[model samples]
Target: MSKEQVVVARKKKKKVKIFPIVNVILFLVISLIIMVPIWKVIVDSFDAKAGYGMNFLPQTFTLGGYSSILSRVALYRPFLISVVVTIAGTFIGLLLATLGAYVLIQWEMPGRNFFAYMLLFTMIFDGGMIPKYLVMKDLHLLNTLWSVILPLSINVYNLVLMRNFFEGVPESLFEAAEIDGCSPMGTFFKIVLPLSKAALASIGLMYAVQFWNDYTNFKIYINKNELFNFQMKLRNMVMDNDIPDEGGIDPNTIANAAVIVAILPFAIIYPFCQKYFVQGVNVGAVKE
Candidate 1:
């Protein structure tokens, strides 16, 4: 090659290398921007002397903040409520998503297209908040845990994701099941569900997170304080200065500690679910 061509080739190689380097630096900077505040919160949660200022490490490391929040009898009801709501909501959501997705995949089922369209319509629109509230009242569901659980349980996005995953199941499996004299429900239980562990874990985690983090529904629908979930109680603690007195622990410390406690479940659970979560999302998202 000519000297000029050789120089151009080297420059091109240098440019290619520079792009990846720039991308690495860009992502690192973005990661720091996101993680810095989270790290600060974590630090403050442990810091008995936690204040409003930025802190990378706790000046006075202590678990008193956590102890105070946990020991408070007032928090117990809300914590239990949150656990019940999360478990029940996740179960119902998964049941609806899986069953509805299965039915949508039955090519011979009458009104399948119409049903799918109706569900899709809901994704585009809904009755406004007041009307929904009125409906809940009419159903005599207000001020109950069901008021919180039922409203958020029917997520159309999750339904669509599950349907997509179900569609990805090989047709041959169904044919084989049919040849073996298996009923539709039997095939679903034996074949479809067995093959859908990843999707279930992925979608279940989504439901659990949504239900766990929910506060607005609880705030709006539940009038009884005893029925309020952890998120609701946490909001009260953080926003309304309602932290329970635990020997005059700094309110900031308790609030930060509560924040950590709130997120801790997912922090521990996500690592275990991550492999299945990634696979499920990928399979549900991609198509031939």
Candidate 2:
């Protein structure tokens, strides 16, 4: 090779080597940005003497923070109630959203445009809180767990997202199923549902997280303390400034423990759905 050709070869090699090094550095910086705050919280939860300042790691490690939060049986009841509500709500919400989306996506359905418009209208405008409260009261759902679950069971945005996914399914599959004498319901369950797991997983996680974090509905409709969700209990604890103990454990420590305890379940559950969740949301990236 000539001198110019040799230099060009060296330039290409240098470019290839530089790209990976730059990528690694960028990735490390982004990872630290995301992980540091979470790590700080984890460490602070374990630190018994975690005062006003945040710590990089546990200073005086102890279970005092956790013990303080857990010692109150009040917190435990709300935790269990929240768990039941989250599971039940997630299931019910996902079912309704999937079914409703499936119905709406059918091009032949009568009044489809009108119904779709109404669903979209709900996304923008809702009956204010008092009207919703009255509706709940009139339905005799007051002070019941169903009050929380039933009122917000179907999210319009999630329904629309699922519809987008359903619309992307090949029309030929539906035609094939119909030729085999499959009913609409059978087609939904056998073909559409089976092929739509990614969309379902993504929407289900969104509903689950919303139900888990919800406190406003419970606060408005539920007066009974026993029916309060975990977030409600945590709010009471934080707002009332009533730390469980006075002897040694600091209030901030207990607060940190409550934060971790509240967050732990979602963190544990997210990993199982992480693989499908990303791909599901990106189902129709390039719409033609």
Candidate 3:
């Protein structure tokens, strides 16, 4: 290369003078703070033989805590219920929210603003729990999987985010699709959705997290232990004072183990959705 070109390349390769030692020290301190509790719980799950003691690391390690909960009827069933409900609820909620948001943006539609207001209104106001229960009872949606899926089938805040996302899409894209003799549904599926994947991805993560963490509706509307969700069961493990009737495992171990299991899936799912969210928002691909 020529001398001028070499100098230019060197100028472009500018480096910052960050202190590597200080950064490493800070990182280690933060990592220890986060990992300590997680490590403690994992150790506690193996602490069945410790015989009533508390410490950061287990003095007596056994898998009894994990085994006992896994073997229980109420416990495992709830885990399954939570998984099924989260998946079903997330998908259905996404479909309804996306479709509704898209249609509300159609200027030609009658009562579009009124419907938008209605949806927005739900974000700020809600009927009391008792009234909601009565309505659910009247609808005969109580105690079924539908009970979990139906009441929270839509969220107004999410609808707004989706509407904003769809509106951010370009008018020319929609116009081009129309010019090509595409129907509304076809244009939406081919052009709008393909470009709006980031918004869809972000909304999907939000819905999944909300549904996965919720147990209140189930507690109020459901009477059967068989229908308990992962969160409700975790609540029991932490709050319920009852020891095992057979007396093999203690309450603390069960509580900690349940806490760990209940949270582990989210720890896995969020980073995945997060990566897509950052990508989608930055590219403006989801915007109209």
- The prediction achieving the highest TM-score against the true structure is 1
Q: What do the candidate models score in CA lDDT, each in turn? A: 0.90, 0.87, 0.79
Tens-place lDDT digits, model 3, residues 1-288:
999999988887886547997899999999999987787777777676434444766776666666666677767778888889999999999899889988987989999999999877877888888898898899998889888787777788777878877887898898999999999999889987887788888888878888898888888888987788988877876677544632655567766666777888988877878877776555434433
Off by over 4 Å in 3: 1-43, 46-56, 242-250, 280-288
Q: What's the C-alpha lDDT at position 33 in model 2?
A: 95
Against the true structure, candidate 3 reaches a TM-score of 0.78
Candidate 2 wrong stretches, greater than 4 Å: 1-37, 285-288
What would you estimate as the lDDT of candidate 2? Answer: 0.87
Q: If both were scored by TM-score, which would come out higher, candidate 1 or candidate 2?
A: 1
Ten contiguous residues minimizing lDDT sum, candidate 2: 279-288
Give me the runs in candidate 1 sitting further than 4 Å from their true place: 1-12, 17-19, 245-248, 284-288
Worst 10 residues of 1 by lDDT: 279-288
Q: Across residues 168-276, which tens digit of lDDT does each residue of candidate 1 receive?
A: 9888899999999999999999999988999999999999999999988988899887888998888877898887666646778999999999999999999999999
Q: Using alpha carbons, what is the TM-score of model 1?
A: 0.93
Better of 2 and 3 by lDDT: 2
